[model samples]
Target chain A: MDRIPILKIGAALLVTIQVDLHDSVAMALEEDLSNMIVKAGAKGVLIDISALEIVDSFIGRMLANIAGVARMLDADTVVVGMRPAVAITLVELGLSLPGVKTALNAERGMALIQRRVAESGLEADHAAGEF
Target chain B: MRIRQIVRAAALEAGLSLVDQTKIITAASELARNTLDHGGGGHASIERLQEGGRRGVRIVFEDTGPGIPDVDAALRPGFTTGRGMGLGLSGARQLSNEFSIATEVGRGTRVTIARWK
Candidate 1:
């Protein structure tokens, strides 16, 4: 089973997807991200899909599920780096990914997560201070 | 994923635009997964088409599993008999320039889609 790496950056977890994911791999990623959110007490989740060439309905559903799960666990998810063609195709494929937030790139995605975390009033220092 | 790669290569070989390549590849992925999950596994093939100086790419997915009983209902968005988003068949239809499906109750199902450059 192949696993996509998830790096804990600041108060969020960053996932840079650099491969075309198989169905099983995408499911695994969703499960792993859920566990990581609870384990790391993550405030946000950022998935970078700039390297991916397509976002099929399966992958689109996976993204929506991840966001739903993260929200239930008190975390936010932001998907970043969708190629122009992929974005156009996604809409045509009838997948708007209703609940998933997206940004143009990873840098901006991280900033969006940080802002959300800040607005949520979850003090990063306090969370770190307790540990 | 391999199916998608083959579709992408075929689309490019047929001179599809970047967005068109993505469209066909994505549509192929959706249909291929449907064959595996709902049809109990199948095969996909890519076809390069040419007619009157027009070039295009066509993909065919065939499965021998339990065929869809209600294709009209299945083609409706948000209709699913499996654990999917119910967008595979309809979404694939939307992403392609030409689409067709042939199926029987217990026989099998064949879906073909084409995109012209």
Candidate 2:
């Protein structure tokens, strides 16, 4: 089975997953992603999904769970690169996902994370000065 | 399998934050499997949307198979008509910003969900 790829980029982590959008694999992937978030201690996450052709209810639920786990770990997450057709299909099916952040592409997502990190650093610096 | 993969892909593509994408995909995968297992194999649709100025992904699962008789009961969190864990419908709903179901006894079932971006 082709599994999703997980990588650490700077303080963030990138998960590149290629999925058939079918059955048991989807379930396993969900579990894997959740575990990665908990174990990796990443400051952020980027998921690349340009290869998927379908979206179903089970997968939707899993994604939501992964997001929840990432949050608990104090890491931000971003989804990138979706096909338009698949997007429409998911909407028509009435599937919903929660606790996930979205971006247009990986580059943009990474940049967003960088900016977030910078902002946080600035906040910390200011607090230090005050102290 | 296919549905789960697709959910993961879509979640990532939608630029969902890592934590958000994981949770949404997990919940979506469960619901997609339920659609196939109980509904006799159906196709799921996904879309990215912006509502009230908030961006998110929208997913729909449609099946021509036997529809649910009691949607309310089915969504009761612990309710299950099958042997697996009963968290499919309820969990999906909890993971998304909006979840709705439309079904007819002899017709079919349609589930609509919106997870804001």
- Stretch of 10 with least lDDT, candidate 1 chain B: B1-10
Using Cα atoms, each model's DockQ against the true complex is 0.84, 0.09
Candidate 2 displacement at residue B51 in angstroms: 37
Q: Which has the greatest lDDT?
A: 1
The CAPRI quality class of candidate 2 comes to incorrect
Best TM-score goes to which candidate?
Answer: 1
CA lDDT of each prediction against the hidden true structure: 0.89, 0.69
Residue-level lDDT tens digits of model 1 in A1-131? 89998998877899988887777898889899999998988888999899889888888888899999999998888999999999999888778897899999889987887787788787655357442
Local accuracy of candidate 1 as per-residue lDDT tens digits, B1-117: 678778888888999999999999889989998999888999888899999999999889999988989999999988988778999999999999999999998989999999999
Collision pairs in model 1: none
Candidate 1: give its CA RMSD in angstroms: 2.0
TM-score of predicted structure 2: 0.52
Q: Give the TM-score of candidate 1.
A: 0.94
Error of 1 at B100 (Å): 0.5
